[model samples]
Target: MENCKQEFEEVDVVFSKTKHLTKEECTKLQLQDSRLVSEFQASKLEIDAKKNWDLFYKRNETRFFKDRRWTTREFKELVNGGKSCSGKVLMEIGCGVGNLIFPLLEEEPNIFVHACDLSPRAIEFVKNHPSFSSDKINAFVCDITTDEITRQLELSCVDVVTLIFVLSAIHPQKFAICLENIYKLLKPGGIVLFRDYGLYDMAQLRFKAGHKISENFYMRQDGTRSYYFSIEFLRDLFTGAGFNIICNDYVHRRTINKKENLDVPRIFVQGKFQKPS
Candidate 1:
């Protein structure tokens, strides 16, 4: 058991190696997704984005996403790169129901977190969790694309920012302003840890006709939107927001469930970007 645990730490198992999609497969999927969502429906989805997310949590609560136990393993900066994590201030944008926040706090109890989500229902879940404490976490509702986070927390106060699976929910047109808001919250030397769905992932390929909002962007049945990212596009995005890229790449993994006869390949873009010191 000890040996297995050691191997888990040594290997980059957070993102398992998986086979890439072939050109023929990509072409077939694209061909099947030729029909696009009507402009009226797309506009409605964008306008009601927050409302839709609130409804999502109201229905599923914290059951939708599993606890993100792999965050520390995937991002060393979260643990101060083997140094003490004491006194570090971190912020998690789009913190849904405290899935990442609670596990992260359990892992490193000394660090404080400021967690925000677009859905007020989600914030309530974070606040009501059994492990929640006012001293350790400040959970709030925020629309990062437009709201001034500095109003709730001071400017340049964050040491690190975690944007896991969050940016993809936003409209592509607002991504610049969203990143700019996050940039304002980080200290000069602070880093942003980003992870999100990548182009041609199984989820993206699964979208059928009338789901596509635009290239690499789609609206789910529940009305929340998602935008797929490529490594080059992600690099340009962070760089354009005045963040210097420390590292950025695509992470591939395979999800398997023998009981259900399910096997799916997942692609994600993960990166670390720093504000110029």
Candidate 2:
């Protein structure tokens, strides 16, 4: 067991060192490191990533997501006498570290949230968090694909379900399955708001030519997986899963700091779908 642990630590170190590689350095590492190449080849990296995500939140939840201090201004505006959230339930599918969960709670004190994720570590982190509360924010460890969370728990259907930076991590084919399940739990006229990576973001372009795992999906050196998505596919998935499209917008943003050009590319695709009231 000790030998196995040492070997695992060695592999982890290699993965960490490879993360900051320049696009050129990335190519060289891919070429020179046969182990890394084989790890990429096996395609079991996604399963390996479940552990990686566990380690990630365990080690860096506070520094990485900074969930404790996050608040969404738009959510604040919307809920503080805004049109949508006066007397509605809200759910965030992958409420990692409770960034969106706690913020949305702070925004509209009256609304309740049923937040879930597949990672038990993530759920535990949220549950034990200083600001966490069972009444305002109910965090659960659940894999929506296999788990009958909504029915088993007897939590009522939600008014709006938020999927923030989450759909990009799932197997692309399972996207529909996820959407269908969420739709089943939403009241008529409920919305699914998504904020995630768009195509050609920095993460997508990091792929070595051989690292491609079927279209826009790729495995990073750290065993974490990512998928880049487009607006058209997102719209189709929601509509096919029994949602009527109300609003779909693509937003482009930039940062302004003197002497530095920060053209960080992001796609904000907001969708408001109703179940035919």
List model 1 lDDT by residue over 1-277, tens digit each: 1243322222222333333678976785677567888889888898999899999999999899999988998898988877889999999999999989898888789999999999999999998899999999999999998956867888899999999999999999999998898889999999999999887888887787788998889889898989989888887888999999988877876655545666666788888999999
Tell me the whole-model lDDT of each prediction, alpha carbons only: 0.87, 0.63
> Which residue pairs clash within candidate 1?
none
Question: What does candidate 1 score in Cα RMSD to the true structure?
Answer: 3.4
Worst 10 residues of 2 by lDDT: 9-18
Model 2 has a clash total of: 0
The alpha-carbon deviation from the true structure for residue 269 of candidate 1, after best TM-score superposition, in angstroms, is: 0.6
Candidate 2 per-residue lDDT over residues 86-198, each given as its tens digit:
56777888777787767666656777888887777888878988878887887887766544765645533777777777877777877878887787787776667666666
Superposed Cα deviation of residue 160, candidate 2 (Å): 1.0
Structural similarity to truth (TM-score) of each candidate: 0.90, 0.76
Cα lDDT of candidate 1 equals 0.87
CA error at residue 103 for candidate 1, angstroms: 0.9
Q: Which stretches in model 2 have alpha-carbon errors above 4 Å?
A: 1-43, 66-87, 154-156
Pairs that collide in candidate 2 are none
